[model samples]
Target: MSRTSHICLMAEYNEWMNARLYEAAINLPIEKLNANRKAFFGSILGTLNHLVVADTIWLKRFAAHPANYVALDMIRDLPTPTSLDQMLFTDIQSLSEHRKSLDQAIIEWVHSIDEHDLDYVLSYSNMKGIPAQKNFFSLVMHFFNHQTHHRGQATTLLSQAGVDVGVTDLLALIPNETVA
Candidate 1:
């Protein structure tokens, strides 16, 4: 697959997995969602919130790209997360709504960019104010990989709480190919 096609696929997978996770998460009581499970982010809600925070931070940075992606314009208005663990929404319902919006924006943004845009070396500062320049494509990969990594943590946490997120695999979203 082409680079843009791959990115578009990842974006779709992101939305798909998030919908499943949130649907499962919403079935739990608020207390259960907030309960600290000793996971990296503390709880299911916390881990999910971290994903939103991190995605917001990255999306804001991406909005500054020279291509001027219209889909990311909404991200520019979002509050910059001060920490990775910052909770944007205290409850699953509110968080799920925002996640849907963000996922849609991500899908639009990926579809808006072509392979040429991915070659640009994006310059941005890290959360610690450290300056760095890196390839945009690699950064986008990190963006999706980061989500998958934390979502795995969330799935495990949910499973412990007896809420299975079912089929948390990117392979499930890949289309079957037919030989010509």
Candidate 2:
């Protein structure tokens, strides 16, 4: 598969996983959901928030909307999720919708992106004032990876909160790709 196509498939899988994650968190009790389990991103809410923020930033960047964050601002604002379960529910819904939008964007880009494009470096300075450059494909992969890492942290915090989330794996999403 082409690199962009591969990432789109992964994004589809990620969207599938978000549904399960949202279901698991729906009735987790507001108090427990908001409680700090000291996960990698600090709290459950924080980790979720971080994932959402990354997605938002990437969406903006992809659309060629001017970038809005600096490295330090990003560092300080990582994963600032809300404590309320209801609000979190809304955020998850928004995330799912945004995933759809992003998938469409990727499809459009992949129709034209080629081996030469992959070699062309895109440069931007992160919040730390450090310049970074990588192939566009690498940057897209990093975007998804950043979400996965924090989701792992959030899942850990979920476990510590005694929330029994059955099967966090991507294969579990839309089983067989038919009924999912």
Candidate 3:
């Protein structure tokens, strides 16, 4: 598969996994969801919130690319997250809704990206205010990878709380194309 095709797959996978994650998370007691189990970000809700914050920050940065992708134009008005650990939503419902919106935006943005645009270098400041320039394609890959990493943590947290997010695998989404 081409890089763009792989990214499109990741985008769809991101949305699917998030839907399952939120569904399982909402089944847990609100107190349990918010309970601090000493996980990275302190609780299930906190980690989930961090994912949203990170996506918002990265999407806003991608919107700054010179190619001017129309799909990312909507992100221009959205506020940049000041920190990765910022809590934008306190409850599961609000967080789930926002996650759906952000996932859709990600899917749209990835579809809008083409071969040449992937070669453009993106310059942006990190949360710590340090500046860096990196290949746009690699950053997009990291964007999806970052989500998967934290969602793995969330799956563990839920499992510890007696909930299971079934089929957390991107392989399940890949179609089987027979070769002659």
Query: For residues 1-180, what per-residue lDDT tens digits would candidate 1 score against the true structure?
Result: 999999999999999999999999998998889899999999999999999999999999999899999999899988899999998899898899999999999999999998899999999999999999999999999999999999999999999899878898899989999999
Please report the TM-score between candidate 3 and the true structure.
0.97
Per-candidate TM-score against the hidden true structure:
0.98, 0.66, 0.97
* Off by more than 4 A, model 3: none
RMSD (Cα, Å) for all candidates, in order, is 0.7, 7.7, 0.9
Candidate 3 local lDDT, 1-180, one digit each (tens) = 999999999999999999999999987888999989788898999999999998999999999988788888778888888777898988899889889988888899899888889999899999888999999999999999999999999999998889989999899999999999
Candidate 1 residue pairs in clash (backbone atoms < 3 Å): none
Model 3 RMSD in angstroms: 0.9
Q: Score candidate 2 by TM-score against the native.
A: 0.66
- lDDT of every predicted structure (CA atoms): 0.95, 0.57, 0.91
On a 0 to 100 scale, what is the lDDT of residue 150 in model 2?
70
* Total clashing pairs for each candidate: 0, 7, 0
Error of 2 at 55 (Å): 1.9
User: How would you encode candidate 2's per-residue C-alpha lDDT over 50-157 as one tens digit per residue?
Assistant: 666566556444433123223223233434333322233334445455445544554444444444555556676554547777666688788777767777777777
Point to the candidate with the largest TM-score: 1
